[model samples]
Target: MRLYEFEGKQLLEKAGVPIPKGFYVTYSAMGAVGADPELERIFDELGGREVAVKAQVLAGKRGKAGGIHFADSPEALQQVVEAMVGSELLGETVTGVLIEEKASFEEEYYMSLTYDTVARQPVLAISREGGVDVETFAREHPDKLVLRRFGPIVGLMPWVARDAAAEAGFRGRELRQIAAIAVKLWRVLVDNDARLVEINPLVRTADGLLLALDAAILLDGDARVRHPETNFPPRQATGRPLTERELIAQAIDEGDYRGVAGKYVELDGDIGMLTSGGGGSITLMDAVAAFGGRPANYTEYGGNPPAEKVYRLTKVVATKPGLHGLLIAGGIANNTRVDVTFEGIARALEEIRPEYPIVIRRAGPGEEEGLRLMRELAQRLGLDMEVYGADLPMTESARIIVEKAAAYRQKVEGK
Candidate 1:
């Protein structure tokens, strides 16, 4: 949920923070030759010195990825834009570029606000060593990093901001100015329900002007309702764009549900798992680990996912080369048909039919019928599937799968 530089700068300007002038253009238009005729007008009006042509992407580490460049002349600007316009960024093709006036930075400073899940509040971070990555700076030069936690109820206060600036070695008027800006940014975060608002290289010019050289903003998806202007249009995995189904699921942030690609989350011990429901999937993983077995993934079918989606999910889970066994588990179901989950697993197993052992522990509503249906389906498909009754403790079922898989692997490997 990282906003592009243009978007970040727009938000910062509205918050009364100083920012450089910039213009954004998508690559859909023709190349430099076609674009120059129109861009010349702006170049003439703005007596700006250096301009930056930055590639817009959701991913970070853009500098490392060569997504940013500087242009000293108008011709150089056109060359940089032409070279960067249609290029792919880490496999996602560049759709647009942000052209901005570069700042004559004499000194760089860093400031940011991030949510602390454990503290259940926001943490304000600032450093004197600014232009570089904050994490690296904090690690190598820990003394320069100053962090203060704000209470969730009170948000950030002016006094706390002053203290943070003082710790970062700022003095007198400069300290007050930077700290006041920080307080304002924090206020923006609280009002806008932002997960993070960061300004790296908040620069001070030789002429004594403070400005933001770059900004990063991450909006809280849960609080998107509060910010109507920030909604992202739906898109697909190949980044071509998303269909209706992808959009529906993308609304929720789930570690269990990945993009179009297969999702696998490693557990402590050694049991490959496929299950549905976020709460139940996590509990199953914990239970498996608690009993000395590992759940290979945190994957779920999501809300009433269709057969094809389940089949697609299982195909991903069952085919993993590292998996020792499989534990298909779920909680008491009210609306989700047990038969659909069972069928998805059965079909996926039938397709791969790896020698790995599998134990299915499913129940609740349509229990008797679903169990019978899966049993018949497995036998007809010439599959060796272990179906456990609902009464069986989930912990016991996971242990059984682990032991069976171990024995099977050992027998096959002659170990």
Candidate 2:
């Protein structure tokens, strides 16, 4: 789960990390003139200082996309807010804006605490050069990027932070300040069950103080059950709204906990995809797009979902309009029963009776039986379906579906 900027800053403040004084203004608050005396009062309280007007969205790179603005006075602040409140940035509606005091900084730095899967422990990364172009800086100056790994049980220690900061070239009081901020950031990450806690341009002010100029935090969704009090907001798509079919699929996924049957994201495309194995789904999506096939949606089901769950999900995908083809594929399964998945998909196909094109590529414990059942069902329904096993590469299946769907669409349009 991703935290909005304000929410992440709130958590950072709670954990003792310093942040600029700021408040949030929701879109509803920006009504007709004089509708919000409260906003006027907030501006008045700021006393005409330069402020940063930042759009509150889940995705990153907002700075480069004109989502962040500067206002030197109350009137400028109002204008900036008005311009950003209702507009869309990176396909996410700007529901609110963060009004913060702009700081005069002597230098900027980068810091982050995240779990390292390769090391199987938590890691802290810091760099003296930081900003919107931190990626480029890291790529060009890899030695400047300092990383320290800590045992998950022992956690981040103050001495370790100080050492890492010193290694990253911090000196004098700034070293202690950066180390303290790092310690607090680690606390925020652990206390909130976060997968990543990042602060870019952790600025050193002219007054010799350190403050977080920006924050980005991602919590571990799987660990949500442990922290029921934490309220993470819903995430929006990168480019568009969720379709009705996608919403139905979401409800079905949350209805039961039999297996992992969630993360259904809709896209603008004609090919409907039902895939399993998280990594495999990503690979197939890329292949489909690489071969000039537009994938309508991305669905991943694995860990042996129940047949009923598969049936509901498949039905949702099958009912999606403008689909020229359907691809049901996955990696060779270890625990998932191929026959059970085939039965559920067959049930959905029987109901929808799509005549365009269908491709199935699955191989697992019940491979032979599942293939036979699916082939028989396709023949009986007179469906244009082709079934493949482990012998065929997943990318090959993607190409076949794309070609078939294109041919089918041309024929139907001609008719």
Candidate 3:
């Protein structure tokens, strides 16, 4: 969940890090174009004509992608905003443009804080090399990079930060300033559930001030429930926005941690898929596609979650519009109880009462009871459905559902 630049800057400011005076603007790309009157007021508020215009998107290398530009006057600002807002940068749609007072810097530096796998804790990386790629700087000039890993309890003490700055060859004033920033950034990372908080080109202004010239922050997705103020919409793998159903599905597992029922990716097709296990979900998706069935989503539930979690997951997936059929299939489960999981699906079906066809093939502990429960539920609901067990291979069941869904879709469409 990589945040936009303006959002990151907000986090930085709240954590007591110095940043350039700025505000951000967002508008719809498809809407009619015009110079916003608010832009003029913001220009006056900045008390200067010299401003840096930056695109707000998840993509990186924004400068190289022409997402960064300078505007010296009202006319220039309008042109830059029009060119930037409602545009594309680095293949990402630009919905917002940040307008800030440009800085006159004497020197540039880099700073970052993130979880370190090897250290098994949060680590801070700082370097005198600022405007360049930090990874390349660390690799090429390891001597210039200073690394500090912090423990969970007594995290990132001030004196330790100052020592690290001294080790990086900074003298008194610079050492104190950079070390202060280090402490504030640690606060930001911990408080905001930020997986990565970075400042590239952390600058020393002409007035001898340390400031964050750029903010690159990525938030932890699992902790999103704790920070609704961020107001981020769920996004798919390719950056498209998630559907309402997908967002609902994701919220199901929040704070539960018992099992996973939130790994849902909505798709274009119509078959509602309720696959289980780890690799089993993906493998079933391929099987369905291989058999000419179009799955409405890719989702899973495993680790023997309570019936409540599965009921929520089932409700979300089964309720998707244009669902021609529903497929509930998974591999042989070692511990996931079939009766408990199937009861959740049955409960959701009772609420939805869909006329669409359904097929089920799950095998695990209490398989017979689960199958019987599903069969009885379908009969009572008067739904057209079939229940299978371990005897029917998952792939074969996939083929059967594909054929049935196709026939059902054709029948509905009068094709």
Candidates in order have lDDT scores of 0.74, 0.87, 0.88
Q: Sorted on TM-score, highest at the top, how do the candidates line up?
A: 2, 1, 3
Better of 2 and 3 by TM-score: 2
Q: RMSD, model 1, all Cα superposed?
A: 5.9
Question: In candidate 1, residue 361 scores what lDDT?
Answer: 83
Better of 1 and 2 by TM-score: 2
Model 2: which residue pairs collide? none
Residue 340's lDDT within candidate 2 is 82
Q: What's the lDDT for candidate 3?
A: 0.88
Please, what are the lDDT tens digits per residue for candidate 1 over residues 1-415? 5577778888888888898777888876645445585455444444547787789876666778899998877777778877887788876677888887776778999999988888877899988888887777799888888988989787788999999999989998899998889988987687678889999879998788789878888877788776787666543334334433334334433444432223344333456788767777778777777766767666665555556557766776676666778888887766677776566666776778766777888777667877887678667776657887678875577677777877876776896
Query: Residue 292 lDDT in model 3?
Result: 80
Q: Which residue pairs does candidate 3 place in steric collision?
A: none
238-357 per-residue lDDT for model 3 (tens digits)? 555567888898899999988788878889999999999978888989999998888999898999888899999999999999999999999999989999989998999999998899
Model 3 misplaced stretches (Cα beyond 4 Å): 28-35, 90-92, 136-143, 220-238, 243-263, 267-273, 277-296, 302-327, 331-337, 343-361, 372-415
Query: Which runs in model 1 stand beyond 4 Å of their true positions?
Result: 32-35, 45-48, 234-274, 279-298, 303-328, 331-359, 390-415
Model 2, which residues run further than 4 Å from truth?
237-240, 286-292, 363-373, 388-396, 413-415
Cα lDDT of model 2 by residue, 206-309, tens digit: 98889899999998888888987876757754555676777778887675787776668888799999998899999999999999999999989988888788
At residue 178, candidate 2 shows an lDDT of 90
TM per candidate: 0.74, 0.88, 0.72
Clashing pairs in 1: 235-242, 236-241, 236-242, 269-294, 270-294
